[model samples]
Target: MKLIVTCLFSVIMVYSTIAQNVAISDDGTYTADNSAMLDVKSTSKGLLIPRLNSFEKDNIPLPAHGLLIYQTDGEEGFYYNNGTPSAPEWITFTDESNALWRKDPNKNVTYLSGNSDSIGIGTDSPSARLSTDGMIEAMSDGYKFPDGSVQATAVFPANFSGYESAADRRWVIAMCADEIPGSWEYQGFEECSKVIDLEWGIYVPYEPGGGGVTGNRVHKPITVIKNIDKATVRYIQELVEGQGINEIEFHFFWINPDTQQKQVYYVITIGDVKVIDFNHDVTHVGNEIFSHVDIISFAYEIIHWNWLPDGIEFQDNAIGP
Candidate 1:
């Protein structure tokens, strides 16, 4: 039975109004400094603050601001109430990351990294930065993807990042009899009747090479073109002279959808890197044929329509912008 009189939880105290000083001690010595209203000292034992397990700690009724305790539950450590009576919050100290992570009495991951400066979610080895193995959500603000983008204005969320843009582009439709790469024929070609029965119409990027250096070199060339029939592709992407609008690039990753091979590509969406080129070949079944059709059709369309005015030019070059 511990007996304390003056203060509810005090151990021992001595006062000398004549000396104009007060002192409290557990080892029978007045070691408190003269300028203190309260001083506690123990030589053989340590002072105990409010200590409770996770559940017990959470049940504090109307805990005042700054209420602190040492929790002995799931995320065992010291915790503090972030000031709320209805739904008091308990912030925990994690030893693994050696930081204080915010905890809502009922939730696990309140904040990423548990307060660590560098945080990685899916992977244990987080970059000396930040990484999430999933999509991030923002209310309605603009965004900056991992690849790269060309914005119509100086804002973000990329007004145009190879997703959709019709400001300065032409349209063409081509179709092929089968999935065979050699059977693709543009809807409109000159000098002869169409031999390939490839009927495909989709806006393809003919505009590339405007933004300055992207550190991506012109990959190895693919050159094999026959009159109206293209077996290969090459050449200069249109270079916008001034303003921020420059080149547009389409990155291709060969993948076969018929066979469920590696799911790496499907797990994530692409749109924010720094370069574009022929990289990665994932086989499922008929991906190569479809890719061939796209390459040939768009290649010729770009050839016939690139750099031409928005509409047809009449005699004497009288036209509209």
Candidate 2:
């Protein structure tokens, strides 16, 4: 009885030690590591995990989030659990030369596809090089805003050349440069008092070397682009055939719908030289008044030369006596 009771005590101690950790050895010895619950040590063969066919894998019982297994039949590869404990799903992490690649279940609704030339968004089969089902945005507003209404002011620069001389003037006619002849209200005409924005300037014409070495003064006329833009200015001369100044071809006036005002476009092509205009304005005005040149004289009379010849110049300064 003492021997039997001693044997039972030894068996109990052995089981208690095995409960903490269990290790299997090829030499038929059970060894355990201090940190791990179970460890297998072998030199001949490796441990084979449970292999499953597609049908058998689908029939798994309750699966946890971190469950792992190896598929044996179709798409033979390793799979991991990407689902919860209740609703578990096995997903292939990676596929080498002998594996398969599947789509993400989360991105099933919106797919992404691309090619060498172009990429497609929200589509699988793209017809064009780069096709997209979403709206696109641009970075420039130069062509977007044809009227230069946003992100830029339409006001033009002051004619510095016009101030060079009282007799010698550089006047830009606005009514001649209209794409379609018409006038609209200022964008914010209500903000101004009864007065409107005036884009007016002065221009006079007289014959050079008329009476003597100086010249002769002719009746200078002031032309403006009012409502209909039919006004005319005539400066008749005796030396040459006097023609109607209103008949001179220029661009007509135009109005911008955004500002609801007449856009002040300058005279670009006056016979030959096309003037590049950088000025625009939207000043409110009720009417443009036209008046005659009051102080007319033969002394230093201004010549009405629209454009100079190729070699000749307008303001050629050469230090004369």
lDDT of 1 by residue, 52-123 (tens): 988798788988777889987688778888768777877765443454455455765565444446667676
**Which candidate number has the best lDDT?**
2
Question: Please, what are the lDDT tens digits per residue for candidate 2 over residues 120-151?
Answer: 66667765665555424345532243532232
Query: RMSD, each candidate, Å?
Result: 19.3, 19.9
Winner by TM-score: 1
Clashes of each: 19, 25
Error of 1 at 301 (Å): 29
The TM-score measured for candidate 2 stands at 0.27
lDDT of each: 0.36, 0.39
Badly placed stretches (over 4 Å) of model 2 are 1-19, 28-31, 95-321
lDDT of 2 at 44: 78
